[model samples]
Target: MSAIPQERRLVTAVPGPKSQELQSRRTASVAGGVGSVLPVFAAKADGGIVEDVDGNRFIDFGSGIAVTTVGASAEAVVRRASAQLADFTHTCFMVTPYEGYVAVAEALAELTPGDHAKKSALFNSGAEAVENAVKIARSYTKRQAVVVFDHGYHGRTNLTMALTSKNMPYKHGFGPFAPEVYRVPVAYGYRWPTGPDNCGPEAAEQAIDHIAKQIGAENVAAIIIEPVLGEGGFIEPAKGFLPAIAQYAKDNGIVFVADEIQSGFCRTGQWFACEDEGIVPDLITTAKGIAGGLPLSAVTGRAEIMDAAHGGGLGGTYGGNPVACAGALGAIETMKELDLNARAKRIEAVMKPRLAAMQEKFEAIGDVRGRGAMLAVELVKDRTTKEPDPQATAKVAKACHEAGLLVLTTGTYSNVVRFLPPLVIGEDLLNDGLDVLEEAFAAL
Candidate 1:
């Protein structure tokens, strides 16, 4: 049986009676530091639709920040996790290792797009995965300094924040960040030192030369990057960029870490986005969609590097929760059975034309970029000037929300509208969501 209810209902306003009541209670009880996106509370979700407490059903384009690739409330994930609940929940892998944890790790080792011997470690979030990957790289290389690219986002943890480049929201006053983290320019074609249309091997060469000259690669432990940058604006490095970086890291004895937290698990038309360029990173950090909406993350990489850390030093209290592992098993099986990679390609096919047409029609659209289901439309004042139109972007986002669609806006400038629909969405519903976007643009 489908996990969603038979019908959707919206008897009152979008926030309606129940949501407003909850909002009042939230204001009273919750800490002021907590923030919210849409005011509507989630009642249930399935396929690519989120039903709010007031019964408003909206087409989901964000996919819970790209975490529910198998769709929220996927049947297989629910069933597997429910069955595993009958077995047990937490054993704290450090205290006592469990088969479920090992099983999930084994799956990751096999599936993370590498023929080399690999080992896997599980954690609760992308931040944890990134931290652990850093730990592994530093331990294996016995180096102190790490190099990150400009506009890259690792996570929100203090160490990851140091690894992250943006400062306003993520690092605003969160001073005393971790030490030995260096940031350099990313090969972002849109705003690179060189022009957009000039992205090629030369761009990669320039960045690498700067890194070598400035950081003196010998002191760097790892060069962590996103195969396709996520919060930095869905920017894909040029054709020769990833390979060049990988080769540079290899020659310098620096671990090449692929932060696939937002680009793995078939979200980018492949098992991992780096695979598109045949770049096999020494370490890969992944989360978001790994467990079909469950809180699970993993760091998979060369067995030697992963094993460099001491045994008791690696796991957390809830590192590989049994339920999340079961969910992951089901999620991976669902991906294989459904061919979500092919689905992502199909989504790209639909989104590219629609977004390209919008770029032609709207003066605010500066760029249409990204891969597969992971796509974005960058907003600007004028195509030629490329001044960010944050106000117009906010208006369009609000319009889409009011019109029964859940679109997400992101970017270093907060002016890019990103689309991350669940891979399971029907093409017709997907098209309808795109049409809503068009209406939003028109209203803006």
Candidate 2:
């Protein structure tokens, strides 16, 4: 059905002459701060394959960092977005509101967790949505302090950088970040100090205690966390952790915000990862996989909290662009039509076992974890010590790229090789990508 061939094909060496030429051009034009995972320039992409300028077709395991759940060139997305584009490009949602924007808001209200009356406001990126969510929470609760977890990545913006834990690339040199942001411990099972068994209750109690004593829970506006930590090595917080935190927020009148940017919209075997624990957030920020590669993010939450912000308080010039809204609607349609949640579960079923088997053979693999297509393997220098092996992570990623499999490396320690294959990726292609990974590990 798709025009682009699904099979991987390598007509030339990875990053061949053409891509090398492009790289030279990019170096001259693009900013040095902007980094790319791979140097292979894409000529075409569809399903699970990205054909490069040099005729090397690589299996896409990163899904453009979990943005394309329904594939890059999904038919419904193209059709609806093209039709909307032909009709009108932009009037700006604020000046002249359109049905597409409202339609998308309606869809988000119905899809996101919670049966309560909900409302949504759209934005250009996840950072904008998160920033806006914080604004709304502050306005509603009349509080200033916000709580975030360690190893949780909200975005690149100043406030989000302060909320984020990583210091090297994210927060390095980006000084004088926004004030009133508090950091707390996340129930990271693999690296929890007291061990995984007590991680949930112990970490939650410590985090709550610190917030109550240090920041004064009464002054806290919000407690934001990723349901499944993304750039932090796909770490799923230990069981009972989220619920405990949510309850604490509720009791303290603090807004419980779930940053579902990378884990929402069927990428995590459910509509939202927060649903896995039946934890209902006061506000949920979503972006990455919402619009089939188009830039669109939203802050969906309780109607009362959302309405706390004045009419003119929330919105940007390009927020909720019609074309992006159409893409989102199309993406939602594709998800329901294709049953992508089930597909994500199936991906997990296939990937986790293989990763576990790899761990059995390879002592360097400290942990294999993640839900659905959002999976990862944390590399370590020694299994006993669990010391991060960022060098091995880099080596394995480079090997995968050379073999025409696109994978991504992440984590606070930079020792996590994360897999975020498109939900539409065929099983054969998925296995091929994993095969490339196994070979990389073996060679390492």
Candidate 3:
């Protein structure tokens, strides 16, 4: 890892000479389909700081898109993974099996929502976990259709793209998607046609009724949704909305799968966002924070539902690699030892107020919402109209990035500025990042 302090220090500029050189090389080698949010190339990242190839350091508010909740290069994770690396790399659980994979499954079964007897199957990414979760639901329910909410983002795979709601970047030109996937309205408080007060029940009724009338609930395999929509702007569904949907799925015998990939692993001040509403989803898909930046994802659910899949029905070559499993165990240990959940709540306590203050000053900040460290501000062209201002949002994000703060933008409309600082980030550094955000707004 590069030698750098926790403080944000810029040597030459945002994307310095070294990063620029690497960017030019990337243009020649990397494909156009892959997007780089910022041109800065990272050499090392620890805690809340990412040291670029140019030796300039930035306070990371993206957490590698919510992958490094325990912080990139967390000591526990590195140590454990190192030990596993020295011992052995891959045995392929199906081929010979390993204790690490079983241990991770045990940990996931305990950590994921619900007290009911639960089981888990490991995978390589959030998209794969969601794909397997859908498989499990279908095998258990004997159904073909999968229901996803408006603005909900699943993944980039064909099946997941079919489940995803966005088109421009995620689904556009991707073409002929998988079959039997349905999309419905989400209880997005800010954008609801009626007021937020009416969003919860109304959206739930609309979605449930649509399924009942159009797809026939009996044919629905699962209802998959992000507890707090990640890529689609950190829109936390209106209160009672999630529980109502879960209940409706329960009544209909449809598997309710909570895609807590970005919101799980203590990112939302709770182990999983579904726990905020005491929701015990039939299956929960997790990935981003599960292995402290290592590529690990899981589909944990009620034993009966999970066991419905036959032997050899799930898993990939790299699924639950021993080293990654070790990293997950270490990350889980770190979360418990440091009480990162409390730290996450503390982060929200510090950030939401600052963002609200910004909202008071900037009319473009039409809405400030989200929970714990995963918060965001929806940018709009008009307060009452709530017309998305993607241009202005991009401008402010560029300003922040140029100034050394790594804030991310999201939303179906591409007009939400998000803050996802690491849970282990010091209060001072968190404040500094927020200060940069404040300046970005002032510039706008």
Candidate 4:
């Protein structure tokens, strides 16, 4: 897939002179609101590594927040995109329809969870796809209320901001979110007050009861969830939780939407995360890794539900750009050719054992959970109380960055260090990144 030296080579102090200069320039030119996990600027990125501006190379543990599953410079993705670029960049799919768009939609229908007759609508990002899913659901049911879970993250748009659960960075000070959005409890096993064993059915029953008592199921339009919660940490809800919710959605005629922006593709060791639980969502919103780093998203759903939207009701200016569609086709091809689902499982097989060993040595690591290439360790001050240790999490991430490894921090409480390495990463490189992680914990 790549010829780039799959090694971590630090030629200078991390965030070295060139990167420091770029950061200064960025401060002046870019908005303060825009943030970065690492301050060093990327010079070039390939398979498993990123060479920063200072000539230092880093093992990429975060795949641009789980976007580049086929790697940054996958040959198939590049070839397809370059071919499309020469053919046509943009005529706007809405203006003059293209085969690439139809091809991408067809691919999604085949790949997404269900076998029932499916249709798709492409968009530019995950948020747009999610917002459109809500539109389709509401149009179909003539209902408005949308239900989401505790650790769920939809996006940053007004309605999605309401769907998202975080406060400080995402929703705070941004007053006046969209209405008709309700929040329910997520089956976070580690944080469940009762216990991990009871989290699944108990949390599901609690959520179902709340909806029935307060926001009557009959009035709800959609119930959106992430099979593996992303931004609110990689919390895989207790096993039976999703099935219960999906059944409730069915019984109440609520359109169940699976937001698979981060966990879609092969990141979760399956074509889609919901398949592990056998819960077929009525509609699924996908982006991020779907197009091998290109900005392409889609809402794929049952034909009857998708057709509810009128012809003019959906679509945007650059909803499915030709080049992006080609990139998606290439990405899907790479997924199939490489058998990335097995690769993802292999990554988990390699990573979980190493991560478990680290936890055995460090009490700060309270929990290690996730599936496939998407994995994380939740930091806490005490194993008993399980109080989040955000300071320790920050220090560990900073240490990894300083040592020429790129890692990311996420969680509702900001105490989880998430790893989303590229599936094509060499074993030696992945282990090297994990070695740095172990060292960071030792230093703490």
Candidate 5:
């Protein structure tokens, strides 16, 4: 059915001659700050395979950072997007409203957690969605301070950088970040000072106390968090942690915003990870996987809160582009038709046990965490110390790349090897990628 074969086939070494040539050109023209996990330049991608410029096809474990849940070139996505491209590319939603934009908003309302009347505003990226969510929350509450947790990565923008806890590449040189952003401890189960059982209640109590004491609860606008922390080692908050936090926010009138950018759209075995704990956020930000591969993000929330912003207060020139909206419609269609949420669960069923086995064999594997297709392995120097082994993590990722399996590494400590295969990926390809990972760990 697909043009590209769903198998791993390496015609040349990773980053072959053609890719090398492109890399040279990229270096000369592109900004140095723009980094890439893999050096190979992709020419064609379908299903779970990314065929590079040199004709080497690598099994895609990283779904372009979880943006292509249905696959790179899904049938519905291509068909709808192609049809929309021929019809009309852009008119700008703010200038001239489109049916596709409204359709996407309606879909999000039905899909995202909560039965209450919901509304949505589209943007071009996760960062923009998050920024706008913050704007809406502040407007609704008439508050200034916004609370975030440690290891939470909202985005790369100035305001998000301040909200983010990590300081390395994200916030290193980007100083003088926006004010009124406060950081609190997250219930990272692996690194929790107390045992995992107590992590949920203890961390929530501490976080709430900090907000109340350090920053008055009345002054706080939003308590935003990732249902499952992405770019922070795929950390899922301890059980009961999210519920407690959400309840606190509800009681205090603080807007609970779920940043479901990476974990939304069946990537975590559900439509959104927040559904796992039954936490109904006041405002939820979505992107990355919303529009197949096109750039589209949205802030979906209770209608009352969303309407807090004045007329023409929220919008961008390129937000909700017609083509991207079409892709989103197609992607959502494919998800339902194919039952991608079940597929994500199946992926987890296949990956978790294997990763657990690897953990038993490899001492470097500190922990294996994450949900459904969004899984990761945290590498450490020693089991007792749990000192992050970023060097070993790098080696494992390199080995996977060399073996024709595309994987990604993420974490605040840079010691997490994350796997985000397309939900449409075949079981054979998934097993083969895991085989490559096992071999990589064995070699290490």
Candidate 6:
């Protein structure tokens, strides 16, 4: 067998001349005010390095929005997906059924936390999985209200928009969101309502009580949350908060749904962030890295609750496509064999210190938070006031991108820089990315 590629060779400046030209073309080709984080147009990728059209190679820390934990263009994943494509591309699970789909479901059932009999339904995106989870919860609990947390990001779908906490980009003009969705406060300690470092489980309990009193516990079908909030600055809820919420949901018959779409697949040092608290959610939604880079998602949960929906209620036209399922099976196998969970911890080991160093030097870095490979740094104008520094954050991110490191920014206030490097990234390349970040901070 050929050896694994291990080099990050750059032959041109990032977003080289060709990439800039292509970006110009993209502006007219794409619609809906589509935005791009990095300007480089990928021509090829292996391991942790991505090569653009102009042959400029750079370290990837965003991992395609956290979808390539195994690394971009993994050998096993590509081999399996290509071989499956040769056999047959589509045999939609709902229409013709396929073994690959069943195989993927079985893997998810075993991987997701919970020894209780669990079932999984596949979909094309995280939003679809989340939307379906809501449907299943309502069907099982016979309730109408759905509760969400502040700074949480579910998806861009109408229902998910209603569930998402951000308003400007996600909910802007997208009005008349699905009804019965309500928002609650998350345990964001750094920007705590009372004061810095003042939020914890008690605040979460208060939010829960408010929801119960205003919306009525009996009417609530589910309460969805990210064990480690992703787009919301990689916030990890205060200790005990997740467990308390899980218990409350159990007592009230409100399905506890963990939105692990960005936090799953060992991104948070555990296969699922919910596992960190030892809390088994009634429903768990996952996507992104599950199928390597393939567009595949799943909603796994208690078998009884999952089965509550009718036969035709849980399927989509392209849900669980055979090709994507094959890719997922291969990706899962690779993750187990390579021990990606350990890899995530390794990434955290390297990043936490480097970021802490940056925080020590940069007064704008108000907070550095996250569990593992999924991490973020929140920018603020002043430590005392904690006013978001969106402009400065954007400047640093742009500089990093131009200097050969692809990064992503996310937050309710657009002042957070999230790092989701592929767990398979090499030590040297990872360090180089961090060095670029340091340079960006200096530039800012």
TM-score of 3: 0.99
Tens-digit lDDT string for candidate 5 (1-444): 768998899888888999999999999999999999999999999999999999999999999999999999999999999999999999999998989999999999999999999999999999999999999999999998999999999999999999888898899998899999999999999999777889998999999999999999999999999999998889999999999999989999999999999999999999999999898899999999999999999999999999999999999999999999999999999999999999999999999999999999999999999999999999999999899999999999999999999999999999999999999999999999999999999999
Would you estimate the TM-scores of all the predictions? 0.97, 0.99, 0.99, 0.99, 0.99, 0.97
Number of residue pairs clashing in candidate 1, backbone atoms closer than 3 angstroms, sequence gap of 3 or more or interchain? 0
Give the Cα error of residue 38 in candidate 3, in Å: 0.7
Q: Give per-candidate clash totals.
A: 0, 0, 0, 0, 0, 0
Residue 1 local lDDT, model 1:
47
Candidate 4 residue spans exceeding 4 A from truth: none
Residue 209 error for model 6, in Å? 1.6
lDDT tens string, model 2, 245-364?
999999989999999999999998999999999989999999989999999999999999999998799999999999999999999999999999999999999999999999999999
Better of 2 and 3 by lDDT: 2
Lowest summed lDDT across 10 adjacent residues in model 2 is found at: 1-10
The positional error of residue 424 in candidate 2, measured at the CA in angstroms, is 0.4
lDDT of model 4 at position 385: 98
Which parts of model 3 have CA positions greater than 4 angstroms off?
A: 1-3
Write one digit per residue (lDDT tens) for candidate 1, span 30-139.
99766776888898899878888888888889999999999998878998999989988887888877788889989998888779999999999999999999999999
lDDT of all predictions, in order shown?
0.89, 0.94, 0.92, 0.94, 0.95, 0.88
Task: Please report the candidate that would top lDDT against the real structure.
Answer: 5
